[model samples]
Target: MADPKGFMTTPRQDWPRRPVGERVRDWDEVYVPGALLPIISAQADRCMDCGVPFCHEACPLGNLIPEWNDLVSRDDWRAAAERLHATNNFPEFTGRLCPAPCEAGCVLAINQPAVTIKNVEVAIADRAWELGLAPPRPPDRLSGRTVAVVGSGPAGLAAAQQLTRAGHTVAVYEKDDRPGGLMRYGIPEFKMERRHLERRLDQMRAEGTRFRLSTAVGRDVGAAELRSRYDAVVIAAGATAWRELDVPGRELEGIWQAMEYLPLANRVCEGDLEESPLSAEGKHVVIVGGGDTGADCLGTAVRQRAASVTQLDIYGQPGADRDHEVEPWPTYPKIYRLSAAHEEADALGTAPSADADARLFAASTLHFTGDADGRVRELSLVEVDAGRREVPDSTRTLPADLVLLALGFSGPDRGDGLVDQLGLAMEPRGTIARDDGFATNVPGVFAAGDAARGASLIVWAIAEGRSVAAAVDRYLTGSSRLPAPIGPYDRPMVV
Candidate 1:
């Protein structure tokens, strides 16, 4: 264990992000590169290493947080990476993107700020990579079986890598031009650089996981035909059916889906486009939704030199501090989260609101008003209570040259014909149905990730992928040694 008194000796500290004024001018990540390595050991020492270690139960990947924390605190970067990778396939992505529910489960959080587990995880993984610890360890022999993985997000990639290491042939099919489904396009570069993703892809390729890009499993290649070709199939196609607001003027030219607008900016990062077709340049942008996706749009708009930007949320803002009365210790609380994007948005704000933040909480959109040329010029909104009952005489209008619907996803993309082709059973909650082993209704077919669950974080996606691969391995050989990380219906530390 680390120093028993270390928690009391060291205060919780995090990596310093780049200045808002400087980061908004470029697509680089907000964090300072290699700036946390020296102090990360002190931060890791802050872990209490409790007897229960609720942090493990809180993580979907069931990461050995205490073990790795101890290793990091002792300056054992290679061993820390080993303990982290034992459960998680991609620590780099999760360390940067996940909300860190493990911190909420930390016993130290009961009194003081939680240990910077995410930072320690990233520091270990990145240091191991720098020291050439992440090399391809190809399987000694072949299993003589082939697996087809649909979608190339975190889940599909995790499944593919695990299956390949298990000595089975794996081919990942992606609808988009690139292999990464959402990670390639949905996420903004300001949050995470694309190089991290590219390096991992290269490692997977070195281990013999083939990628079939721009190949839709249901459209370009028939799902039925694919099932016959491969011994087994894992459908990790994420929930992409965007939830929409059907209010009036939704069909205006300036309106777009979050998926639609986010990818355009990503294309610019890919050098495929000099500028996004729907760039918010010189426009007043209004982003609907208060989640991380909405914050991403706000940051992207500010980077695109928008005249002004505002984020609207249907629910009232959460408390600044955790509500222990409603969600007590070890539970992921719904506190007001000011993401890095929100901080950047604050520095870039042009108008001064009453609350001094760009966010408009407890707000509801009524309708949009377009110009004579049928382009959206403004939108109408009103205030509402927690019950969604409208407040009297609260109607207001704001100029909006561009309107982005970041209202989140409803379910899997049904229009792509994957469901119709496979005849997969779907739950009423708009997710693909699967058994305890992650197997679908169809024999020899399985589902995982957001396709089987609702829209969730990347940690859950990678966990589901790793779990489903073990099931497929058992199905193929009638017995296997791979570890199952989660059940089809398992959720961790969800408040």
Candidate 2:
């Protein structure tokens, strides 16, 4: 246990963020550099090390939270890193990107603030790398088997790393010019610097995980050829089929899907372009969707010096605290929380919506008005009731030279032809269908992550990756020792 009574004595304090004025000027991560190491140990002490430890149940990766908290509190960073890496393959990625349901389920959060689990996890991961404790662990002997992992996202990377460490010749095929999947192109550099991703890629390469970049599995190489070449295949091509908004004037010159806008901005950061062709500079931007992706667009637009920004959400605004009767403890709650991107938008006075955070809840987009040049000039919206029916006389309009649709993804993109070529079965929700063991209808093939489960958090992706690797190993070598933390159908504790 971290501290028998330290949970009572110490109050939870999270890692501090860089000032908005300074951070908004560049694409660096928002957190203050070199600030976490000092406060992380104290934050780790706040872990009560509960007898039940609901945090474990909340995390999809089944991370050893209490064990590592104790190790961190005792200043055994190396041991803490080992315990953290025991279950989670990419704590750094999750620490930065995940919403941290583990913290919501923390025993301390029953009444008090939860322990700073995310900050502590990131600190341990960063320290592990700095201390040379996270070296590549090449296999002792080759299993004489080969595995092909489609996609370079978290799930595919995790599966490939585990398979490689298990002595299988692992090859990861990616359609993008670089790996890391969305982490490389969809996610902004301000959220998490790509260097963290690059470091992992280097480690994977050192461990003999070969990456086939710009190679679409079903397009460049035939499905039959891949099946005959590799002993096994794992499809982790994440859900990227974006849900479209069927509204009028959606094809205006300045309107773009969140995926399209985010990737182009990311390309600018990647040095592929001197400037984003879809820059939001000097435009009035209205984002239709009040999710993380929408906030990402808001932040990007704010950084691009958008004249004004407004984000609309179909759902009503949630309360500040959890409704105990409804959501209760230990389950992820629907509460109003300010993400870093929203914070930036709020601090910069970019969001001109009803909420202070630049978000207008219970709002539905009706249509867009365009200028004579066929560019979006304004957006029409109306306030809705609980059932999503527009309230009478509540219609309004906002200046919107640029419109971004950040509606969530539906399923894996079918443009690559992998599903059709392999004859993979799909669910009604458009996700690939798999068995309890993560196996697809096609023999010697398995699926995991967003491709099979639809859009979800990064932690779930890593968990699915680990689980599918174990299942694939068992199929390949008959009874393997790889850990499978969660099954393919495992879900998080959310109301």
TM-score of each: 0.98, 0.99
Q: Global lDDT of each model? A: 0.90, 0.92
CA displacement after TM-score superposition, residue 22 of candidate 1 (Å) = 0.7
lDDT of 1: 0.90
Question: What residue runs in model 1 are displaced by over 4 Å at the alpha carbon?
Answer: 354-356
Write candidate 1's Cα lDDT for 1-495 as tens digits: 678888999988899998888988999999988799988998988888788999988888999999999999898888888888899888999999899998989899998999999999888878878988788867899999999999999999999999999999999999999978889999999888899899999999999999999998888999999999999999999989999999999989899988999999999999999989999999988999989899889889989999988889899988878888889989998888778877877776643441436788889999999999999999899999999999999998889999999999877898878888999999998999999989999999999999999899999999999999999999999987877878987876545
Error of 1 at 321 (Å): 0.9
User: How many angstroms is residue 469 displaced in model 1 relative to the true structure, after the best TM-score fit?
Assistant: 0.3
Backbone clash pairs for candidate 1 read: none
Off by over 4 Å in 2: none
Tell me the lDDT of model 2 at 77.
Answer: 86
Candidate 2, position 190, lDDT: 91
Error of 1 at 413 (Å): 0.5
